[model samples]
Target: MQKIVILDYGMGNLHSVASALQKVAPGDEVVLATTPEQAEGADRLIVPGVGAIRDCMEGFIRPGFVPLLNRCIETGMPVLGICVGMQIMMARSEENNGVDCLDIFPQPVKFFGTDLKENGERLKVPHMGWNQVQQKIDHPMWRDIENGSRFYFVHSYYVPAENNDALAGETEYGVRIAAAVARENIFSTQFHPEKSADAGLQLLKNFVDWNGQY
Candidate 1:
């Protein structure tokens, strides 16, 4: 049986992410993994987060999950990171006074401060609500999800990866944010698929079928 493990470092909405995965792939085992052994044994892995980047990084290192995560990526294990989980994959974040990150993407997460504006109007800092995701490159995870599909987003900071090829999707909120990023065996999203409606569900379904290929 295929097992999909959601790493539990006590910083994410674990139940909701698990529930969403179960709904999409009921036949597959969806389990929350609190230990490194459980996480490393999964057929697929998900790193979901909701909180400050500093706390998330601390949670990862506190439980000795950093090495396990690195091993998973090195072994070509299919992994997905959501929200702040995605941000920490970068080299560093400007949140909480410049915290160092995992350096998976060699990018930096930038905060959309209160001064951000669109057409002379100040945009909200937390860029919350539904926004359209413009597909930047063709990817298997984007299989059934159409271009310009709307997804739910709630974030104050965003990743602007240096490599454009790694950017799978982009969205606008006074600035173009890296909505989704993908490399071999790994895919990350700034938007919450669990919170998004139909489009979000479809993307999750695609992830279930993906085999870490482009």
Candidate 2:
């Protein structure tokens, strides 16, 4: 049986992500992995987080799962990162008065300007609500999902990856932001797929069926 593990390092909306995975991939064995051993054995993995970047990294450290995460990425397993999880994959973050990250993507997480505005109208800081995402590149995870699909977003900061090729999806919030990023074995999204209704579910379904292709 295929083993799918969601890293349970005590910092994410674990229940929602797990429930979404179960609903999408009922046939697969999904486990909330709190140890490196469990996480390392998974055929596919998800690193989901909801909180400050510093706290999230601290959560991983408290359980000593950083090596496991590095191993997963090194072995090229299918991995997905959501929200703060994705942000921490970058080099560093401006959050928590500046925090260092895992440096998986060689990018930095930047905070949205407080004075952000659209058409001379002030916009919210968190960029909360349904927004259209433009698919920046073709990949297996985006196979069935249509371009400009609306996904739920709630974030005060965004990753503007230095490598344009790594960008998979783009969304605008007073300015363009990287909504999704991808490389060989990793795919991540700033938007919450579980909260995105039909389009979100479809993306999750695609992820389950994906073979870690670019």
Candidate 3:
């Protein structure tokens, strides 16, 4: 059975995330790893959060977080970050106090502070609602998922476009936001696919079943 370690940093929607996966991965062990050591041997690593970037990074500095997360991902364990968890996947975040992220992606996270969308209006602060996601690349995380499907989103910051080939999906709010990203054994999502009902469940199942096919 595959082992999924849900990173428990005390600020994420850990219960909901684990519950969502349990629906699809019936027999798979879903463990809430509060320490890095607890997550070291996980077959899959889930970084689930919904808070400021600064505090999130501080959480990683705790005892076993850094080494444990690094070991798991570097050893080819599939890692998936959700919501703000996804933003931390980037190298840096211009959000609160200029946070230094885990550097999973070289790009930095930017807030829709002043950038206006296609409508020429300053996009709302937090783009919270159901948005359509277009599949930009074929990835295991999105296997069997149809393109142009709607996913739930609630955030003010987003990842800018980088290497186009690394993009798996995109969502448009004020402007396009990185909805899903995949490169090698790492993957992440800005939308709460877990809160998206059927579409969300499928996504959880897909991640649970994913064998890292880069």
For each predicted model, how many residue pairs clash, with residues at least 3 apart or on different chains?
0, 0, 0
> Ten-residue segment with the worst summed lDDT in candidate 2?
157-166
lDDT of 1 by residue, 45-150 (tens): 8889999998999998887788888888898888999998899898899999999999998778998887999999999888899999999888999988889999
lDDT, model 2: 0.87
**Comparing candidate 2 with candidate 3, which one achieves the higher TM-score?**
2
Clash count in backbone of candidate 3: 0
Q: Could you tell me how far off, in angstroms, the CA of residue 45 lies in candidate 2 after the best superposition?
A: 0.6
lDDT value, residue 71 of candidate 1? 86
Candidate 1 off by > 4 Å: 161-163
Highest-scoring model, lDDT: 1
Q: In terms of TM-score, which candidate is strongest? A: 1
User: Per-residue lDDT of 1-214 in model 2, one digit per residue for the tens?
Assistant: 6788888988866888778888988888889989887765688988888888999999977787778877877888889999888898988999999999988888889998889999999998888999999998888888788999999998998987345568999998887789999989999999999899888888888888888877
TM-score of each: 0.97, 0.96, 0.93
